[model samples]
Target: MADFTSRRTLVLRRFARNRFAVASLILLVLLFVGCYTLPAVLPYSYEDLDFTALLQPPSARHWLGTNALGQDLLAQILRGMQKSMLIGVCVAVISTGIAATVGSVSGYFGGWRDRVLMWLVDLLLVVPSFILIAIVTPRTKDSANIVMLVLLLAGFGWMVSSRMVRGMTMSLREREFIRAARYMGVSSRRIIVGHVVPNVASILIIDAALNVASAILAETGLSFLGFGIQPPDVSLGTLIANGTQSATTFPWVFLFPAGCWC
Candidate 1:
């Protein structure tokens, strides 16, 4: 416990020492708060139609203006952000967890187990994930599709990371403690969980952070391509998609979401 605390403190100190990382962390926190909370506080709804205000420029009355459907641009963008965040965070966690588990097992227990897992990883590497997602997502309904989107991304995202984990675990598994645990009749699962997992956790944590950004961008791209969140289900991607044709004439529609995407 003391060792874990010291490691955590060290990580915190390391993170704090990096000015850009600190600033980015603060900015992300603020952005998340604004995206998730401001919508409930505001009077506007993403789906609410204001027939009189179609494509109006930004004003105090409509902060980011209105879309062609007269939906509040600010509200739509916020809603999009909320969905995107959900997909990003969930996919990152799920992907990282799967990666850690798969990698640990494959590495620790070599032979057919390793062969099968590596084979699957290699197969996934060659697969066209986004196109498959595009082909399948539209068939699912909106709310369910969002969950499915997270699952699909996480499912596809873990392969490379898992292969990395397996390599790390291969080294860790041959350590004295691991061998000792095996000789002492400690369960393979327990040793992997208590020893192997923690040792590789730092890598997984970093990968998860990176995965969130990747997942968010993936969601944005898929949604923009009309395979993700879909219409009436506004996410930043959908908002950008809606604005594409009139991006020149009504730049606010496209630009607001694009800025948020950045």
Candidate 2:
């Protein structure tokens, strides 16, 4: 526990030392708070339609404007942001957990295990993940599409991270401490959990941060292609897709959502 606290403090200090990282973290926290809270305070909900305001431009009443369907653009974008953040955070954590576990296990117990895991990793690396997700996502029930999409994105997202973990674990396993733990009769699982995983955590932290954006973009692309969050449930991708038709005439339809995405 003491060691863990020290490590965490060190990490916090390291992160705080970077201006861009601090700014990004603040912005992310604000985004999360705003996305979840502001909607409740706003008069318009994403589902609330105002036929009178159809394709309206930004005004005091409707900050971002209204879509062709008469839905409030600000509400829709905030709702979409909530969904995207959920998916991005979930995919990043799950995928990174999967990668760390798989890589640590494979590297710690080399030979056939390593070979098989590496082979699987290589296989997934080559497969057309986006196409497969696109084909399968449409078939999922609307209620569970977001959940299914997160699973699919995570399923294919961990291969590279796992491979990186494997390499790191391989090097760590031969270190003096690892052998000392083995000689002291510590179980393989405990050693991996307590030592291996922690040592590789720096990389995992970086990967997870990167994965958040990657997952969000993946969800956006899939949704834009019409395979992501289904109707009645708005996502940034869906908003962009819906707005694409009126992009030239009603640039707010496209620009607001796209800008939020960026």
Candidate 3:
């Protein structure tokens, strides 16, 4: 218990001392809270239309102003945030899970498994992920398209994570405790679950955060191109896409969503 406490304190001290990580964590938390709370408390709905008030400039009543369709820009931003964050979190979790499992299995049990998994990883790494998503999304139903995109991104995203985990596992498998466990007749599964996974978790967490940012950017790019979260739903990317047409006339339409991205 004392050892665990000391380790945790050390980790916290390290994290606290890292200014970049601390800033990122603070921004992430603020965004997360705003995404969760603002939509629920706001008076306006994302889909609500008041054509009479269309294209109004920023005022006391409409802080960020009204869009081309007369929907509240503020409301749209809040709602879009929720959607963007959801996609980012989902992609990160799914991608990390797939990467960890495949990488661990392949790394622990070498020979053919390692060869095949590595080959597959290499094959995926060769292809452009965005191109793959664009091709695959159109063939699927609208609802399924998001899932397909997530899976496609996760499938490709796992390669780097797999390689990282595989490398770590190779090093970890030869550790004194691991060798002791093996000598004590511990099952491969037990050694992996009990030893390997815990050791690799810190790297997994950091990678996951980086992946979330990447996934958000990718989703935004897709939505900007009209391939991501489609109509009747709003995302930061979709909002930005919609705003582009009216931006010259009503700059707030684009600026509000762009502010959220910043």
Best by lDDT: 2
Candidate 3 local lDDT, 71-93, one digit each (tens): 98899888878877877878889
The number of the candidate with the highest TM-score is: 2
Q: Which portions of model 2 show Cα errors greater than 4 Å?
A: 1-26, 139-141
Question: How high is the lDDT of residue 236 in model 1?
Answer: 85
Minimal lDDT window, size 10, model 3: 134-143
**Candidate 1: segments with Cα more than 4 A from true spot:** 1-29
TM-score of each candidate structure, all chains considered together: 0.87, 0.91, 0.88
| lDDT tens readout by residue for model 2, 32-114 | 78999999999999999999998899999999999888889999999999999889989999999999999999999999999
Superior by TM-score: candidate 1 or candidate 2: 2
lDDT of every model, 2 decimals: 0.85, 0.88, 0.81
- Greater-TM-score candidate between 2 and 3: 2
Pairwise lDDT winner, candidates 1 and 3: 1
lDDT of 2 at 181: 98
Rank by lDDT, descending? Answer: 2, 1, 3
Clashes of 3: 0
lDDT score, candidate 3, position 39: 72
